[model samples]
Target: MIIKIAEIEEEVVFSGIICADRFKSDYENVDFFGPVEYSLKIGRSDKRLSVKGHVQCSLNLLCARCLESFRYEIDSDIDLQLLPREMAPTDIDLELERDELDVRYYDQDEIDLTELIEEEVILNIPMRAICKEDCKGLCEKCGGNKNLNECKCESGRDTRMAQLLRSYLEEEGDGHGGSQEKAIKVKKG
Candidate 1:
């Protein structure tokens, strides 16, 4: 969607493209349908190419533990000062950088909106997807989903330090009063 600065006054949906987004795995259906809402503003110097807007989309993702799919929303704000590719100013203060391409550039009279909108959607995907806040997930011992039904596997959740200390006491048998001091030291440590 190219928003020309000279010919825009009201807020309008100039460009809306629903792409496959295969480069990023946000949607599994090969094509995640969405839109990008943008508008143009004439700058102080009467520049012909300045645009700002927001992007939003939603899709389903499968949880790793439970193997169930759920909904995920992709929403982000975008504010970019569009500039002609040849007129883009070179950043003189970029550390460890030379005369290299910095960001997405546009032609003399038009702008490409696909790249920026896709970037926002790709960055919004979470690292881990869960069905619910209190998802029980699968049983550790047996391969079974704990959300739907209970498992016969023994409880292996041994995160208690006190229980481990008691087991160590059973092994040491309080020899010469050294174990008690060691236990206190361990606790303090």
Candidate 2:
């Protein structure tokens, strides 16, 4: 996965497929389902290097809402500029130019493609993943998946509200006969 800068004369285009198993150790949170196929263009001018590429892969992600595992496909483009550490700006207070956002410094004569691919994949992942819109999550009362089954629990009332409601009903019925039983039936209904 290491790309040697010395191998490239001026510019070179390389294409390859990295197996899903190769990234398992590096990206433990992601479950890669397919190979990452990529095409990279590497260009070197004096001490500066530029890398541009396209990567494609499939992943298994868990939905944040329903907690179900689902497949997601990713096709992303990457562009980076590499400068020698010595060539980087020395001023700490200087504002970074717009073009410098994507710039990176390399201390060695090689680039690690594995780390690059891992970064790309991780960045493309959604901040909050859902299996589908309007996904019904698990029922809080019985721990039943609301998307798959219906539960008889009172799904709306909070525990604190229900307790306060019960106490209020008991107090209201203390001055009246048989009103507590009627109020209980009404609440259930």
- Highest lDDT model number: 2
Which 10-residue window in model 1 sums to the lowest lDDT?
A: 180-189
lDDT of each: 0.50, 0.69
lDDT of 2 by residue, 1-189 (tens): 787777778998878888878667755346877688888888999778888998878777666556777776777787988877777776664327614568877777778877787777666666455555455666667877778876878645558887588557544534433322221111100
Identify the leading candidate in terms of TM-score.
Answer: 2
- For model 1, the superposed segments whose C-alpha errors exceed 4 Å read 2-49, 87-89, 92-104, 156-189
Q: What are the per-model C-alpha RMSD values against the true structure?
A: 14.7, 15.6
TM-score of model 2 (CA atoms): 0.70
**Model 2 lowest lDDT segment of ten:** 180-189
| lDDT, residue 38, model 2 | 88
TM agreement with the true structure for every prediction: 0.55, 0.70
- Deviation in Å, model 2, residue 185 alpha carbon: 51
